[model samples]
Target: MTLFSLVATHADLDLETVGILSSGAADVAGSVDVPAVTLATCNRLEIYAEASSDDPAALEASREELIDAVAETSGVDRDTIASTFRTLVEDDAVSHLFQVGAGLDSAVIGEREIAGQVRKSLADAQNAGTVSGHLTRLFETATRTAKDVGARTALGSRGRSIVSVSLDIAGDMRGDGAAFYRDACVVLIGTGAYAGTSLAQLQERGVRDIAVFSGSGRAEQFVAERGAAARALKMEELSEAFSAADVIIGCSGGNRQITAQEIRTLAGIGPEGREKDLTVIDLALSHDFTPEVADLPGVELITLESVKMAAPAETEDSLEQAREVVDAAVQEYLTERQQRSADDAIVALRRHTQSVLDAEMEKVRKQHGCTAAAEEVEFAVRRIVRKLLHTPTVRARELAAEGRTEDYVQALQDIFGLEVEPRERPEREQPAKRRRAEEFTPAELAQMAAHLQKVPDGGFCPHHRPGEFAVERLEVAQRLTQAQAS
Candidate 1:
């Protein structure tokens, strides 16, 4: 399966459109014949899906189809869709997801929250039963890539989420430039994760008077859950609060445009008014109002764009390190994922070989009429079969690890007369031994089959041979269920 990524971030879609797209993202993906995950944050919305093939025309058609779907679902125009969306395929898709999970794609690079967001996105898809094997491995790899970026790079160290960065911008825009939101009357828009995060950040910055406006009707519960001295206001109350607010932070995630006409009543307020120079921050992808609202002389506007530019982040060193780490992770994910191609062939070959060994052993038993010598012959033949098969299996895996798997796979098919059809998910089997792991992911099973080779016939006494046979735990038996795959 080919990976497909459709990303709409702060650079493209506004917070509101992103919210709209995300609101029905699952339903849209559920309409397609593939595994998919949609991750929506305060600053970005990304959809990762798997398609049937890697053909350019096919992928392009799928891309347009997805864009049209989002346009219809969110009620946005084609131009907004075209301008704000970026489509990535296969390798680029894998790399881009790693970058995002690592926080490099965020408006505020290296944001720590994105890693958890990535995990949650994958979990949500899994819960919905929408993830296939390839998508599952891709997301599992993404979380690891994020962890590596955080542990091995400076980008993670100096990273901050958009929430904290917006707060910083608010403080900077204040006339005194001394963390002004600490004592200001703050009006926070929206009642989602961003709203909750913004509220917490405002509280951290010492803001006592806070009011929230809910676009999706979740405000009362949100305020009550926090147990703070905060007021939850209806949408209509926004204008009155806008007139009296010292600072406004928008996390309102919905498609409704905050038209300047709605708030035009405050146009004539002078610089000497009670809340002169109203600081309005649009943290949402969709602006709180048309850009013209900032034109009002009495208001100073700040959006995520300004926050990103003014961010006091040390990014150069961290970014380069993160890129290198993601590149390595992409390679690792691809190589390990491709190892499965060799697995089916190896299993079939060994099973075919085992059938021959069993046939020959039965013949020997019949020839010698069940003597001890006949039993010894059966043991000797089994050891020989294992020894003969070991070299090709080990070499194929080594080549797979080097990303040179096709030749080995073709060689096996040619020599053993094997027919291999690639599978997305492995066949689940009940264990023959202990059931420690309830189930294994496709990626894990691939590695287990390739790397954890089983010893011959469970015979620990290799005194008849030149090699030592270590009896690993029964879990090894559970994993080496070649017949299950067959």
Candidate 2:
């Protein structure tokens, strides 16, 4: 099978385009004849597919199909995409995926959400009915390796995601994050995944009494799930809520932006509307708040562009640890794959030899014509067969495990005069039935649930406080805006 890949990461593509690419990939599965899986996160859009053949024309056609699908969905030029989008084939494709799972390729460098994203990609393929055993094995290996790296190494010892990073930045925004969250009346906008995440973050920070405004009018149900007694607001209460809110976090789905006019109207409402030192965080890809709203008096807006993970200072050591883990995992995978490939040949050779011995033993028994003589003759032949086959069998298995299967197969044919038919592994109809990953104890579920949400670190991160780059950038933007105002 010929594996193919294409990647667009945070360095090049925006999150919106990445979302488009993911949707395209989901739809593209219907069109491609080959088995394929797509993994799209805020940081990267990647696809892995195994074609039936490695013929150049076939590969080229497959490549073009992927490029065209992404182009149509994201409206990017094929050539432009080809320029920056990395392509990997066969083993290289496998290596890239492993690194991604290991978090070596993460934007935040060893972000924890990637493992879940990898799992999600596999699940999505399974639900789409586009992936089979090979992809499943690869994904399982990658995820297992990722968990190993996280647990064993310093690569992701703290375990952080984009949510944590964003929260860390927010924490550093107004002194300590924990302090800000504890005292602040947080107004959470949106009723989707991010909203849930934000609430979890607040809960983690000991923040309750959160005002929920559901963009989809499902606030009551969302609040009910948490057993929260806080009153859920309708769409109209958003402005009134914002007036008293110390922080308004927007993680709503879609393109419903909060206009500058809305803030102005709130300000015009007199005492309650005159909010001081308001912090607005728009975590949505399609920003929930307009930029002009940030220019409002007593307002501060932090979007994805401004907020980023506070990368650990001693990251060189962490990166080295991560690389080592990935390298070891890859080597292990390669060895296992080789051993599996060898199993069929080894089994075939043994079966072919056994059949010949059985025929010879039958002849010897017929010639002996006596029970005692036939038994002795049978024992002798078995010993001869064992002695004759021992060295070749042992060497063949060794060669197989070492990725020298062709030589092993050839040696069997040349030395043993046995031509073994290649064994075919049929596609498994279903994965071995097992508990869903989501099945866990209440405490375990809470921890896992927190992983999916916007979990803010408690100010102990390496990038905890603002550095020169972030501070300078903030100052420059403020200066430019001030000049424009004057």
In terms of lDDT, the best-performing candidate is 1
For candidate 2, the per-residue lDDT at 264 reads 68
For model 1, where is the 10-residue window of minimal lDDT?
459-468
Q: Write the per-residue lDDT of candidate 2 for residues 328-410, one digit (tens) a residue.
A: 88888877766765776678777887899889878877877758888887788889888977876777779977689767766
TM-score of each: 0.72, 0.71
Q: Candidate 2, residue 154: CA error in Å?
A: 3.4
Cand. 1 TM to true fold: 0.72
lDDT scores for all predictions? Answer: 0.74, 0.73
lDDT of 2 at 254: 56
Per-residue lDDT tens digits for candidate 1, residues 103-212, read 88776778887898889888888877777777887888899899998899988876587788877776776755444766788888788667777888788778888988
Q: How accurate is candidate 2 locally (lDDT)?
A: 0.73
RMSD, one per candidate, in order: 12.7, 20.1
Per-residue lDDT, model 1, residue 58, is 70
Residue 28 displacement (Å), model 2: 3.4
